[model samples]
Target chain A: MKKEQMTPTPLVQAIGLGSAKAGFSHWWLQRLTAIFLIPLGLWFVFSLAGVPDYSAATIQAWLRSGLNAFWLGLFAVTALLHARLGIEVVVEDYVHTRWLEVLIKTLLSLAMASAIALAVFSILSLVRGA
Target chain B: MSQPQTSSRPLSPHLQVYKPQITSTLSILHRLTGLWLAVAAAVLVLWLYGLAFDASLFQALTGFFSGLFGKVLLFSWVLAFNYHLCNGIRHLFWDAGKGFELPKVYRSGYLVLAASLILSVLVWLGSL
Candidate 1:
């Protein structure tokens, strides 16, 4: 046999096994947003503690302030993103069935998206002094 | 890897026969608390929506949260949040290729537990 014909193909190449490239981005973003959340979460807890009243007007006023509204928006967005990523990891690990996994993941993405949208709208309304 | 014989045999260390260790327990709790926090975030969105929309609805929701059951639920939720945060930091350390030693792992686990409890108590008191 010719030399080129005698070479054996690597098993992985022959079998066409390829990397999924899923976990790295999810893992990195989860950690990055987690780092963001540490300070943001603390700020949120402290800000809530500082709220002297839970009345609607009071909360609206608090949220209306430019700085508070800005941070709240950041917090809401970062938190939802982080949460969606974390839950995706759990689902990937535990949901063994492919269709069920896809279904659950889609539902989760929709829920998170809606939550982020509603939160941002609420913040905007508050900022608009509505 | 080869497919082993499919026979009726007690598989390796099934949950029923396994004694719980702190590491495994904490790991499980991490996932559970993460799930709980996701639900809590949804509730938060509702509260924000209420605040922006209706006064009476906001009042009712606030009142509910201020009641006895709500206080207990909030406290537990806070605890879960703290625990998850602390353990998440520990996990990040592991991801960086550190803290894999057995003693250090257990030590960090206990530290996370204790810090979570203490921080939760402090936060609740501060809120009150």
Candidate 2:
């Protein structure tokens, strides 16, 4: 066989493929946080529904309980993280421009982070009777 | 590979061409509900902050949330939240490489919708 014929074809030339591996972790984390949110979210909703009064004192007292506070914090973190992941997928699917996509993702990340921090801080404050 | 030219390329099927099906409809709803839930989460944080910060502010927020418009919004939020949760479970099943059959997919889609509506109603009634 001639030298050119004997040489193996480049994989990209033969297969015409490119990397599509970046989104697996994002997808997996979305599912993971989603699983965590199931029970936590159900519990939170039921508890909130059972609250007879929407008064601040009542809500604060509910949050002051260690278990409630802990679960609330966990729910907030998991939920916001899950939301960010989901939003990221939506943005990726719809937003075609690279710069625009990056901008939206950054804004979403910052917003989710701020929401999580505010939720956790509020929970802690309530637990401390602040 | 060379990229296709933007102007002459055929576009993918979207709402205009495609007939609406349960699976596609649910998928869109899932994204929308997820978006709404993010906003709801931010509002929740605000409410918590109000509760923690000042009684007056908390009361005002609570009053607003208890009003008719607020009640409607909360009801919709509850429905959206449950729908998203149920559909997330369905997606997890798909991730596990199960329930891809057409019948199963349609069944699960309807199940999620019904469960979400029923749960939302129960929660709303319980709160009343």
Candidate 3:
């Protein structure tokens, strides 16, 4: 009796069948955020460096400024997103246990969410002078 | 804890004794970059927290960051960030089962180095 050969799906594709494609989306998002951050990150470093006597007022004013806010917010959000994705990869690669992986991934997501919230809150405080 | 007994002879570790391969170099560099990123993130979190705090703290941090040592650390972070980001993407391709050929391995290695240099120069110029 000849049994038909069945092809095993690639690991990359296998992720989606059980995991709802979240892993792939996260990986892709990390790359996308990295692409977005490169120029913005450079601009931010330069912008901060050129400022004179970077006091609290000066820093607040910069964050409050429309130009600075846009870049800062983007960087903050994208950085957290990318970090979450990166950390998730590290966790998945090294943390072999099923429950541990899920726990770590969940914790990472929560941390990223908190960081973004803190960043936005901080920026808002700066903008509002509070 | 029992340490593994070694033969009563001098022995070199794999890295010290073997000719370096791309995969080995890439693995070591990846871990190094990861450690660098961890340190960089700590610095960044402090900076952000400083921003949230009152003016004196912000000024203090800014002053320190403008100093020579601060600049060097910042430069190192920049290099590590660029290198890791580039190499991580390369890993993604490998994960997808692409670029396993010898030629592509060398090509991507050079690409990572070149891209890091260009980005670093652009960053320095922007800073100045």
- Provide the global lDDT of candidate 3 against the true structure: 0.72
**What's the C-alpha lDDT at position A36 in model 1?**
95
Per-residue CA lDDT of candidate 3, range A1-130, in tens? 3445743335534454465556578767876876776676657666765666456666767777667877877877776677677677778777867788899889778867877787777776667666
lDDT of each: 0.86, 0.85, 0.72
**DockQ, cand. 3:** 0.24
* Listed models, DockQ each: 0.40, 0.56, 0.24
Clashes of 2: 0
Clashes of 1: 0
What candidate 1 gets wrong by more than 4 Å, as runs, is A1-16, B1-11
For candidate 2 chain A, the 10 contiguous residues with the lowest summed lDDT are: A7-16
Q: After best superposition, candidate 3 residue A9: deviation in angstroms?
A: 13
**Order by DockQ, highest first:** 2, 1, 3
Candidate 1 vs candidate 2: which has greater TM-score? 2
Q: Tell me model 2's lDDT, rounded to 2 decimals.
A: 0.85
TM-score of B-chain for each predicted structure, in order: 0.88, 0.89, 0.81
lDDT of 1 by residue, B27-125 (tens): 999999999988888888989888888677777879999999987877778888899889989998998999999999999999999999998877877
Per-residue lDDT of model 2, residues A1-118, tens digit only? 7876764434535364655466678877888999999999999888898887887778777877669899989998898898899889889888988889999999988888888888
Question: Tens digits of per-residue lDDT for model 3 on B62-127?
Answer: 788789998788888888877877787787788789999989999998898788778777767765
All candidates: CA RMSD in angstroms? 5.6, 4.8, 7.5
Residue-by-residue lDDT tens digits, candidate 2, B34-77: 89998888888888888887667777878988899988888888
